[model samples]
Target chain A: MALCNYYRKRKLMDNLVGWWIRLMVFLVVALPLFITASLLSKSWLILGHISLPELLFSSVWRPLAGEFGFWPFIISSLWVTFIGLSLTAPVCLLSAIFLTYYGSRRLLGFMQPIIDILAGIPSVIYGVWGILVIVPAVGKYLAPMLGYESPGFSIMAGGIVLSVMLIPFVLNILIEIFRTVQHDLLDASLSLGASKWQTIKHVVLRKSFAGMISAFGLGLSRAFGETIAVLMVVGNVVGVPENLFQPGYPLPALIANNYGEMLSIPMFDSALMFAALLLMVVVVVFNMISRRTIIYLESRQ
Target chain B: MAMETTKLSIQNLNLWFGKQKILNNINIDIPENKVTVILGPSGCGKTTLMKTMNRLVDLQGGARTSGKIILDGEDILNTRRDIALVRQKMGLLSQRPTPLPMSIFNNVAYGLRLKGIRGRKKLTPLVEKHLIEANLWDEVRDRLHDPASRLSIGQQQRLCLARGLAVDPEIILADEPTSALDPISASVIENQFFKLKENYTILLVTHIMRQARRIADKVVFMYLGEVIEQADVHEFFNNPKQKMTRDYLQGAFY
Candidate 1:
């Protein structure tokens, strides 16, 4: 009778613990999604009769006059993200290859800690560095060399600073991914008389292609969402940039710069919320695509 | 019987990994167009010795070697010649099969493509030929373009064998090529070694005494990083010169 009572208490405890776990999991999973849906619904209702497609397609962004076209901001964001990705991914990939395949242990050990430190640095610090260093360098030398007048702030400066921020971030991830390429595979390629370059190109790169793409996606999302550093160097002008040296503004900077005046301006709150929704969608889409590609690659593996 | 000619000669080869001596004063004359199996217990530096022959040992960090590995009268230890060029003259099969992350056709074609062979017209027949030689063509001919990793472990090993042969190396270094395979696959690879000996000088490292007995024309018996006995297969087993070799053949190595 005593043993039966002990067993019944244990079963009751297990049921209680199981119920707690399910509730905890549900709260964790549903909280963010619930918040996002509620926010999106509020913005959609506030948007009222203003069709989203018109706002996206139109180039005018005069929120003061009730005109809320965000096409220029969208374009600028995409343009900067493109420039950052194009510059960062290849350079980071090559550096990763160099570190993993050709670097000596001592050199790698020294570089690794430095890379970790660089990755941990704040974005605002990068902004200050860009203003003090990159802007002046571009204004004094790079602009003149290219026969362009410099205002000391341009999309090019933003991209350069952003690339510097992203290289170590992407490189750290890629190096780990490349390291996962089995040593036996490398030996097989080498034993087949493949040079180091050939082996890296054909075997190592191919094996880690999905992971590398995911790394690029991370860089892309970060580039899209980055505000403070880009704001300091990107000139904060809301227009489609004509060239690399021209002033431009991205979506994150747009929202950050204008969020203070949102309550006073008519329909501006809804516009900015819509923009936030757009950014969220983009990040979600990129993450989804990368996750799907990684799953596919792993399935093949 | 035809007179055996030396294809590779190792003279007093010594290898160190960090501070530990892995291969100590090794000397061997590997005959051309024959299967020479290096039989020893695990961790006996048998794999290290085969890797040293191809200079694959040099790829390891903190690995240092002294003495010479002469291949066709060229000292492979010398750094003057291109490592890839030297490596191209020999092929190596690892213990586990690692197919390149590509289709079966591409895996075999990889080496040929690197050596400047291109165009589907040229690659298709050559890939098929090497696949046939590796004895994997009949099963995979229908799925040549499928991912190489889709094949079973045994088929992958044979595919790796085909990939190795695609380079047209004069010497084949196999490090326990069948250790990871089941009995059927092991027999298939053993049969491949027998057929391959007609054209390539095969250097195989295996701890399985029976495998060495079945396929070796010449045997190199290693113990504690030193070769204890090396002789013709029959002589080594029936009349071992060293007591160590006799004890090893009789399953005394622990």
Candidate 2:
């Protein structure tokens, strides 16, 4: 009887462990789908209802006449992402250099909390802050000096906010990449008569090239998809204006605004879903390229 | 007497990393054109002593030092700029094989480029000569443009030597240059050290006694942050004066 009881308890314990692992796996795989089910399902339903040709070439984004062409949004978004990454890349790259090369223990210890705080700041908060602070600062003061009429809540504001949001992300990734460079290689380069700057140029950057590309791609993708911050400051104009001071709209904002209204105009809603699908493809391509680069680098090493 | 000779001298040297003392009253004379081997057990201040000669250990946080180290009659701790120049003057090869992540040619040419030599024709032959001296030329000369990291462990160590020599350093400081290699490669490295000493003063720290017997002109025995014995290789092996040295020689501690 005692032997049978011991075997029964052992089986129970093994079953408990197995059940616990299954629960963990369920949480890992099911949580994201559960949370985003409404949005995804809505997009899918709209996608199924729309005809093929109308979804393919419709770029007009006129909400009043029900003609919502998405070309202007695409153009504006591409430019914003380009400008945001261009601004973020150099500053974040330089910051990563400072963190890795010049930082003492005390300096890094002090910077940790600041980076955490920046990383925790909400996108909407950045949007509101950018509108209140940057728009006027650039519009009333900096714009007049630069000979521009009105540098309003347009590309300039959106780009600045997007850049700020991407800084912490880029910084975090780059800091790790920079830290992974071996000290022996650093010493090897230094003892070889390479000056500090020369070492940075030749060995430091050379070793981290793939990782840097991955980080920059991630930052670019974030800027491209950034919605709340861009929406709050972008002034939500439909047509592409010629200058930086004019209002604009991008894909994420268009999707967010029209996802609810698509119930009334199912056709327009399907068109929006198709837009989401297109943007997803773009991001997927970026991610694939980044992964390929990282994998290629790993294979070389 | 000191003006025209004597590459470096250490007198009454003591080093401490914070509260933990690592080197105790070390004294030695590093002669020019000869290879000196320092043999010790683990945590015996041998590596610390090598790093101190070029002031590499001095920059690490909380590391403190006393006494004097003179390189060609100048105090090592007098200034930072001069210390850097001395560090540049002494090419350092760590225990592991460390080549720059570059082409075989660039690995050797890296130092030359730092000195502001940009001409390809000039850099190429100089690199070829140093690689030949390092005993890696015949194997790698055909693929100088290929990455240096693709070479085997022994080949990488030789490439490191070529890089060090390319800098034209007056002295070479090696901290266990062959502890990472196989026996045959280790012997090959020992041979290169013999050839290299004709031009550069070589100070090597080794845990291998046989290697020291084969290559070292002078041997310094260290234990527990102190130098227990210093003598010519033959003398130290045949007749160690101190009791601790005798015990170490008998392989009791190892």
TM-score against truth, every candidate = 0.94, 0.90
DockQ score of the complex predicted as candidate 2: 0.53
> Quality of candidate 1's docking, in CAPRI categories?
medium
Q: Using TM-score as the measure, which candidate wins?
A: 1
- Per-prediction backbone clash count: 0, 6
A66-177 per-residue lDDT for model 1 (tens digits): 7777788888888878888888988998889988999987888999999999998999999999999998887788888999887768888888888899988999999999
lDDT (Cα, tens digit) per residue for candidate 2, span B71-159 = 86778755556444666788889899987777889888888887778899889889989999989999997888887778999999998
How far does residue A204 in candidate 2 sit from its true spot (Å)?
1.6
Candidate 2 local lDDT, A148-221, one digit each (tens): 87657787778888989999999988989998998878777766656667778898898998899999989988
Q: In candidate 2, which residue ranges exceed 4 Å CA deviation? A: A1-59, A63-68, A298-301, B1-5, B79-84
lDDT of model 1, residue B24: 95
Task: List chain B TM-scores, each candidate.
Answer: 0.98, 0.95
